[model samples]
Target: MSLHSMGLELVETVIYLTNTLICVILAVLVTDAWFRGDHKGSLLYWMIAAWVMFAADVLFASRPLLSPVVARILPTLLVTVGQAILLIGARVNSGQTKVTLVEPIGAVVLHAVLLTVFHFLAPESPLRRVSNGLIWATLAYLSYRGLRQSPPVFWRSYTAPAKAFMAHAIFHLVRTVLVLLPLSSTSEALNTFVAILGDLEVSFFMVALFVGLLLAHLKQRNEQLSSALAEVKTLSGLLPICAWCKKVRDDDGYWQQVDHYFRNHSKIRFSHGMCTDCADDFRKEAEKLQPSDL
Candidate 1:
């Protein structure tokens, strides 16, 4: 291999290494959140999609030793499925009701068929040029839709994820251009520079991801602190109580259910199923309902 190729290889290796580190950190956070049920607040499949893309990057970067067919096919399949899932997640999270699965799957399958044909019929040519275009086109379209129709909470509380999605789409678009553009012999310096710049882009993605997670963590912590502060109270003696109902009257002067009043006046939430009497009443009511409805 020439020095330029060697340099490219080294740079690619470093880029993949950085992605691997990011994957590890993301995996840890994802795993913990998944187990603890904290990620229930967000789209689980979208996070999985990011991990799949990370896997694809690792696979593609190892193409020198691994079979070229496997490298190409693996990333292509992953990028397709991952991006599709991510798009779906973004739509759902943003409260869009209409999403058709067939379009993305069909596009991916068609591209795979074309790529497989080209790999066998014209092995000398790189087919990723066309594949990248399709993927990026989809990404751009979805990113636009997501940004345009995003929820208020998505914009206010968790804006980073939205921005990350858009930024990712933009990067994929740039990748499409890089893959599609022809390289000239006279542009060797430019090619080298672009290669290094591409490596830097990967670094930028990692840093962005790290910053996103940090923001998420801080946002969560701030919310918790706010809640704690909101619930803190300085109570005085001889609080007003309802004479007949035995319910406490708060400073707001509203008569409330014992549990409801406590929950409103304090920080805790109620748990457990209905009591025996309530359960019995519910069963009797159910029995009285129409058989078809039941």
Candidate 2:
């Protein structure tokens, strides 16, 4: 059957549009995170770049046959560059602890340049295979960096979002392999794999982006809870005690100045007053004592 008659065109169109929308969502999330103080610097740039590449992919797929080779190659280049930027940005945002910016960027640039050259040198051969392998390898490296650099608190707090991004990366890598394999012999199998991968990729990215947005808010809630708990820990209450000492020690520590300690440690307010017993004791003590005891 002819290409249009084979029913693949509609599927491809849908996949392209879905991925484009996912990328847009990711862009908005990255921007929001930067504004909310969760992320900064190169990561934001790379996300924006990825969004642009997704747009280009949408435009290219709209008229795939009519699009020029440069049109295709340019977006691939942007993807390569953006991936490197993201690697660097991860290091920067992570406080230079877990990710190393220089080495990863250098590796991505080297591999991408080699792949571009291979595309021209051996368009219809295994050199392209090697190039595709490099792409997956680079993605694996970046994923590793992202996982390693994220703090334990960040991990426990945002595990689902992290998994979403990792799953999306895996889907992209699988799709890359699918594209690299010779498709003439196993067209049906390959087409099914492509559709599945496309759906996974779109869902993974879109969900991850939204989850990331909510993650910052979740962290804020956690902070507020912690603050409130601390406030409750050292609060004091009115407890009957000996009036001779003029000091109060609760279940915790020996409080030197009850009013000062409570004011310092908790939200309790105090008013100075003497109880009936203390007032009567003071009055009787005064009556027994003469004006000049000597």
Question: Which has the greatest TM-score?
Answer: 1
**Model 2 lDDT, full chain set:** 0.59
Query: How would you encode candidate 2's per-residue C-alpha lDDT over 164-275 as one tens digit per residue?
Result: 4455556666666676678723676665655555554544655563455356445645887898887775453464444876676665756456786667667777999999
TM per prediction: 0.64, 0.60
Relative to the unseen true structure, what is the C-alpha lDDT of residue 16 in candidate 1, on a scale of 0 to 100? 75
Give model 1 RMSD, 1 decimal.
7.8
lDDT of 1 by residue, 144-190 (tens): 46634654333344446556556766776776566556762246666
Output the number of the lDDT-best candidate. Answer: 1
Segments of candidate 2 deviating more than 4 angstroms: 4-10, 36-50, 59-67, 97-99, 126-130, 157-159, 168-192, 195-203, 209-217, 228-251, 255-294
List, in order, the clash count of every candidate structure: 0, 0
lDDT per prediction? 0.63, 0.59
